[model samples]
Target: MGLFYSLRGFFRSPGAPPRDAGIQSGQPGGYSSESAAEVTFDSAMQISPVWAAVKLISETIGSMPFNIYEVGPEGRKIATAHPLHRVLTRKPNQYQTDVEFWESMALNLAISGNAYAIIQRLGNEIVGLLPVSSSQVETTLLNDGTVVHAYTTGANVKVYGPQSMWHVKLFGNGIVGLSPLSYARNSIGIAIAADNRVSRVYSNGAKPSGVLTIDKTLTEAQRAQVRASFAGLEAGNDDRLFVLEAGMQYQQISMTPQDIQLLDSRRFQIEDIGRFFGVPSILLNQTFGQSSLGSNVYEILAAFYKLNLRPYLEKFEASVPRWLMEADEAGRYECEFDFDAALLRADLQTRMQANREAINSGQLTPNEARIDEGRPALPGGDKLLIQGAMIPIENAGLKPVQEVPSGTQESEPR
Candidate 1:
């Protein structure tokens, strides 16, 4: 009987050769009658280790669906196979049989920490086989003290960083896709064609060829203050607050009550409100006492009494001694009958009430009611006192605030 076997089965082993019909002789079991009939099978069936190794590798590689080829020196095609060859009736074209596919796959696997290198050839040129090793991986240190490892083959590259799924990708043309490799860490992978001309390096999927920098000039205190400012706390009146002096003539800026509170709280007394307002404490006190309609005692009482001026008068009377006190021609006491004496007495009572209300309401707002505006306006609706001189608020129907000529005089009421 004739025996038939597939090509794959035939290559599985080195077996006995077929017996020729011409060599047959009349024997009990129809044995071959040739002079070489006594030939030992061991000598004929011997196999080389190299061939066995190749066969084993081919068999194992054939199990995979990827196209496989044995590349040799001078770009010789020693062998070629595809996983689908058994199922498909036709074979794949030469393009599928080239070394480019294997080279690309090797690059991808190398970047992924799989096989380090791949060996293949194009036409007759033997591309060197890549050795599997991790020494070629690149490392980088981040500003936050993180170390990263990056892997690259000629065609593909990958990076493993602190973050999850961070990587970059490129093609023969140029950059294509970039993203994280895995969600567990900020790793990234990139791919490119073997013949691609462009070269790029990516970190976390972003090209990083230029200088990287971070400003670290701020002191710890300043940094803390900046952080606090975002949290709604006063960082102190530095340039961080208003840009210009408070009293300088410029565009007016509106402020909410809360804004005012924060401004006052954080303002650097010497640098901010005090210097910019240009009002020294002594000058401020004199201006308030002279131009303000109410007494300092009344100001204190108003805070605690909630806008009532009566308590100030009551406190003033109780604090003064019952004695004849001399007054100057201007009705100002020359004997120092009271300085802030009245204010001091009312302050205790006022502060106590203020504290109580503040505690209950959880509100602590400073008193900023007294502010100097340089000049005061008269009640009649058209006069301003500039250096004790009465000036018209408007000229005719449109009273101009500018100074009139020295020789010019106001028109008499007609």
Candidate 2:
């Protein structure tokens, strides 16, 4: 009876009519009349801001050191020198370098809300992660509530069970993720249009050739010859001069004021594109003042990490152990991106000051601080140090005051 019910549920049709498909080709959101045209990841890259923002984000995340570590019972972390670490830090596959694999996955996750990597195993041990293009992959729902991934490459279609694929999703239902490109399709389209217009003005010889007025009426042959000559001059014939025997006036037609205004509009459009991607305008090199964040580069970086990068890191942390670790090791093992290097990347003076404070506060040993700064540890550096003046609150003011020496005299008031 249970098997029959499960089979029926698997093959059951939707209770209601399907809504309009979304701007993205395979997304589930209902499309409305006001929906904009489709903007694929490739199409969106045409807009420079979109390209830059995506590159900035993906490359930044990819460049971070990713490691797999074991968590002990007392919350101590021990770095795992496993095969997965080698694959992630060196090369995931033959065709892609470490950075390339990570950047590609990050780009897919940012644009499509899902990043898929095919896990290759040797016997029961996992060996490699091969990237699968998100565009060519689809998720299918089965009757038993099992979801399968279908990856289409050319004429070949390969299906994968959930266990065989490393799937990272953001803002998704259980089956599939909702693409950011689909939601911001209209904004991306507008940015593309603005970019195209700017490119037309800057490239493609968009200048008006000016009006050539002849005082005397000419034959068809004469008119054709005149047009050809004008075309030749406009086609980068810088040394060519127009020889007009008849009465001809060459009135230059310059770009209109409105056409010139497009340069400014393009700049604004770049910011708009950044906004859709959650990138601050300052990061795009735009003229946004840093007054709000008080002009501190460190603060701005902290904000970027927190506001822009933290969520993505959190997602990876949650998913990596579940997907990459053996089930038996799940509770004790995990993966993390080591962000301490980035967070503490500062001038030497600042670093020393911070390190001194940490050591004095008994939070870090002198040797640990030396290790972080890439210096050799000294003898007796392993012990945690606290400032001599930093007594416990209960012992404050408990010591007896000493009397002044006879030879010492207090300075009289000036």
Against the true structure, what is every candidate's RMSD? 47.7, 8.9
Q: TM-score for each prediction? A: 0.13, 0.76
**lDDT score, residue 198, model 1?**
19
lDDT digits (tens) for residues 197-256 of candidate 2: 656544535544467889988999989989877764443424456686577777767664
Weakest 10 consecutive residues of candidate 1 by summed lDDT: 186-195
lDDT of each: 0.28, 0.73
Best by lDDT: 2
Residue 288 error, candidate 1, Å: 78
What is the C-alpha local distance difference test score of candidate 2?
A: 0.73
- The parts of candidate 2 lying over 4 Å away from their true place are 1-40, 79-98, 202-206, 209-219, 229-260, 288-294, 326-328, 389-414
In order of listing, the candidates' clash counts read 21, 1
Mind giving the per-residue lDDT tens digits that candidate 1 earns over 307-359?
Answer: 22222223222211111111221122111112233332444566567544643
